[model samples]
Target: WVRGTRNGDMRDSPEESPEEQDRDEGSSPSDAKPDVTWLGTPISELGRMPDCGQQLPRLKNVSGQHTVLIRTDLLQNGKVPVPYPAKFTDTWDDVHVKMPWSGMNLFPVINEVMVLEPDAAEHLFGSLLPDMVQLALRASELCTKPIPLLKGGMNHSITMSQEQVASLLANAFFCSFPRRNSRKTEYLNYPDINFFRLFEGASPKKIEKLKTLMCYFKSVTEQRPTGLVTFTRKSLDRPPNWKSSQSQLTKLHITCEGTIEDDGYGMLQVDFANQFVGGGVIGSGLVQEEIRFLINPELIVSRLFTEALGHKECLIITGTQQYSSYTGYAQSYKWGGSHQDSTPRDGWQRKCTEIVAIDALQFRSFLEQFHPARINRELNKAYCGFARPGERSQNLSAVATGNWGCGVFGGDTRLKALLQMLAAAEAGRDVAYFTFGDSQLMTDVHNMHAFLTARNISVGEVYDLLGQYYSSVCKSCLSRRPDVSLYSFIYQQVSSSLAPDASDN
Candidate 1:
């Protein structure tokens, strides 16, 4: 089962006129050669690492393996094959993070992090998943709003108010219900203060449209009704048996009878592995890595819309906001790692192989089995547009809502990491680390095989590395905007006696 992609409405039969098709064909003719490009070495074997000028260190536990980490800075050439627009969340530092375990809570309490505990992740992540979904959906909806189409020479693009765009992105990431009287920080309610704000100049029509969209979303789910809950009472409501449950799992489903149109706010249902699958470490040969893949239409919709808005695919990475990064399309080539002469070492190869076997079915089944629960949740919350019991209500006046959206899957950015690593390899760097997910580590290796064949350390080991990677990126992002406050500034901006309807100055 795929862990982190939502199923999408497959009915997009965009009619292409013959003229249009011919025009497109004329622009880029089909080639006889396959589009696939292997950066180095044979597909069957992991290659060796080449020496960079930098010194290399020995890997832990691999007394026999000569491992040296490689680092390089370079972008890949060509349109890397992104099957679908990949979905990824932009870290506060501008690093693209992948979506791993489902449910909306992208920002889990850093202090509360416990690797491999699915149940704990669910409770923490689920608490905010609904809100996150709402924000993503609302943002997408805003994108569909009527905008003043401004033609730029031959290309026509809608004019988006800088504020509107900021609002849309803020809504996508920080859009949340009003802070509860309780001081507990809700992930959904936190918007970044330094994020790009109001544009210097704005058109009246564009501003008006932004207001209308924001107001419309506000009116629909202001109360945060625990709507249409899905997932069987046996599977959802109560927590999962984390101890026996898979080590890493995320679940999602919709709860209601609404069609994709009218109230099809994208998200129908969602859940995740609650336990850490506690166990003692296995002996060297006995360690097992299991990835349960899941895909739901709601998630797909959420990702597609986000991809369009960000102009970046989201599927490749893994983990949560401020917690983990992705490695899918954006970093596929070098995500695993790189070696010299195009060969992947034993460690790098292992990471790449793990990437290939990712299961898409597990996630799909989680939703399929719980379809009834989703319908029931929909029934209970049908009174209001969207609902989530045991959670704060969405503020109708805010530009975003949690329940009205969907989520990206098991926050892993495998593809993006690989691509980045490949670019590094080409640029002649030693010991490069790709922070797309818990994976994406490379040392001195010559070919793809050498890099691909390297033994992967435990996910826990990788997790530690990721924590360091993300922390550095976060620091970099924070450094760029030291003066910006997050939620405090947002509260101040909207709290002025000025109602949203107030005319633009």
Candidate 2:
């Protein structure tokens, strides 16, 4: 998938290699007019604004050749012929080909250097497109059908069959839902899955992302899996006194290496999500959760109907399959290749793995995060995500997470770690923290955990200490040791309280 085709594939057939096929057809290796036309109009002008509820235009190729235009930058010595239309000549832009369906006016963005597979294209539009369109229409009708909201520490989980997921995704594929694609502050809270941004002002990076997405669609449509999946939104009421608890703190393992997905199988994986749900899937922002969604494209479908997660809310998704492998981070990311998910299904035919999406506050100023109210909000958010409905400690698995909001969100790693630990302890669950290559954080967290453990400090004690530390910092009492780390401050506070008379001895 990512590398294109293998040597022994159909591309190597006697008719012509895929690249040569592009050249021999309407696409010219040298600057020459393309043999195809749209009702005598130039290919560039074929992009007309679509009407209401109109289907996307049909794609056509000259000489009955089914070809896909791939961007040149992604290939070696790849270039769209100079004499082609201005849209095709631009090196910085994705190749924009007008669809053939009359009155249907959507342009499918493709690279300038590749050709399409007729069989693949036929299967994609012929078999999949109609059903996808119908599904989208049906979903639109149900948008206002009044599903119950998860509120006030309530626990709710909905099971969506594979067919239902495909339907939800179909709406996203067609960009059918309204109130998306707007950057206005009000709409910022919602996830946008429409390809409008990708279609307009397309970039090489965006084009690659689009390719990975298309490959995912191809795989799912070809072989519809019979498994069902579940999405659970959990909310929890804050305990009045987390400090007075006598319960021992849940198990804790902190490391500066590894990731939630790779090392923490069978554990609940944490998705450091944007409030908008899918994060930057439609854009170029690739962070922790975004990267996870790309590898497991099925997870992207959640954005279809998932509203922005609130402060007291968290989403738990089960049974989404990982369909692709990727490398790099953020802008440098690339789809490595196709992946076949082999994770076994449970009695419900759902994958046993579970993922929790919890959005962290995007603090503008570091100090804003330390306020008591802000801290409480984060605590509730994490606790909501960690709490398993009706499950006790014996059945609850440990949590797997990393420097969740530390990257783009500009969060304090130590503070975030402590918050997570407090929540996990409250829910009677353990934590496996990955620092994601941050050695300093790993060491510091390990030392802090050790110090707290040696003194048998409960999570409630840590919570009380955090309040005292925050007050000291706020009152400028700790300005004398301004460089002191959060962990050190907490450690000193806990030690003094635990062995107050040891200093005199």
Candidate 3:
């Protein structure tokens, strides 16, 4: 949702596929300006599921003819077409519940990323209390290679918390090193720091946790069986000793997070061979092979089997990885904008430098109950025509006037009740109706059902209504846009609940 303010606009990046890019390249549809596309790649009813869970619903493979909306001004009025082909209807979820309904509200913190380098490494990693350390503890050690977030500034940083650093370290430490004949240390300039650098002058308590974290990394590196994966440098690449390997080769078999079925493995090499004394190569030192892997932390966390702490079946990991670096006062975009074209080229040069992980099981579980059905229904009803309560218009008007802009009621009792209802809802309860602000209107209705049958309350109707309610009829009618207040609330609540607090934000 793009919210317009007196000053500027704020929009969240929803995942769009190649087809969506094509449609966005053209004229937007008159009726359906792009709003939130349905969640996930469309799955058919007969879609495949992971071996562990029930099959999920899928939509038909969309064709290019589908037209989605695009901001003409953002693209200089179509000078450069975004690769978003919005060819399908803005689909709401299929299932839903009535309003005045309350179920559950759970927000989970899943993943985070940060910059760690000589300048900020101490600041970033020093803040943790050992007891709270989760990922980068001994079990998973962090590994590093030169992955620049800035265009030319090699002094940039990529830092994650101890837990993620540990997991990352565990996954990559002791992997094959780049061969001496073809070293790339010039590209890998970030100062190397690890668990040892941390807790150097630690308290006994902090030291204990640090020890535990280090031990975990050590055990994995020493005992875990290593495996091999190929890293290909196209012939035209720049010349470093490593790049000079003319004959095509599968040089390193680094540890990675993949079996056979999943090929999301990443490529990395820890260069310990080249020694610099007075900026020149010292007598050839024994090449130390540090570990690096091409693995998505989200996939790893998703696959882990655990029952303790906040655990959920499906963890929802959502966030953007952008190029950014710190100046004096604030962060400036490292790359001007999302480097859609340059990402593939530069991504290969950049390596995973740090990890910031979180436990999102509770949040994921809460989100599961709503799904597309709940969101479609609630969002639909919030806008559709209201069913007049039994009370007179004056009474209803009084309630509306009273609650206008009033923060959600339900107080402490309501919060407790909502939490209880969420638990019951998980067991499949009929309490969704009570969750809506306009409970009297959206009686037990599926979101798609409302979309199909509710003559007075289409999804568009709700958007218009919200635009009308939040900003007033005159402004909405004039601009045909909802105010920032409406969508910001939705995004703020959703994002913080889904992932960890982004320091970059």
Candidate 3 lDDT by residue in tens digits, 16-120? 111111111011113432233222112121111121122222212123211112221233211322212332122212111110001121211112222234345
Which is the leading candidate under TM-score? 2
Which one is best on lDDT?
2
Candidate 2 Cα misplacement greater than 4 A, ranges:
2-155, 178-189, 238-240, 477-481, 500-505
Better of 2 and 3 by TM-score: 2
Mind giving the per-residue lDDT tens digits that candidate 2 earns over 300-327? 7666446677788788888777667665
Clashes of each: 188, 12, 61
Q: Model 1 reaches what TM-score against the true structure?
A: 0.16
Candidate 2 achieves a global lDDT of 0.56
Q: Write the per-residue lDDT of candidate 1 for residues 1-505, one digit (tens) a residue.
A: 0122121110100111111111110011123322332222221222111211122232221222211111111111211111111232222211111111213435442113222244653585433334333444444233333222111111111112112232233342332212211225321121111111222245332232233223223322332211110101111123222123222211111111111211212111111111111000010000011001111111111111111111010111111011011121110101111111111222211111101001111122222212323322322222111122332222110000111111122111232222222222221221112111111111111222242324322222222333333343324453243232222232233334234555665
Off by over 4 Å in 3: 1-219, 222-461, 473-505
Q: Give the runs in model 1 whose Cα sits over 4 Å from its true position.
A: 1-453, 471-477, 480-505
Query: What are the Cα lDDT values of the candidates?
Result: 0.20, 0.56, 0.20
Q: Tally clashes: model 1.
A: 188
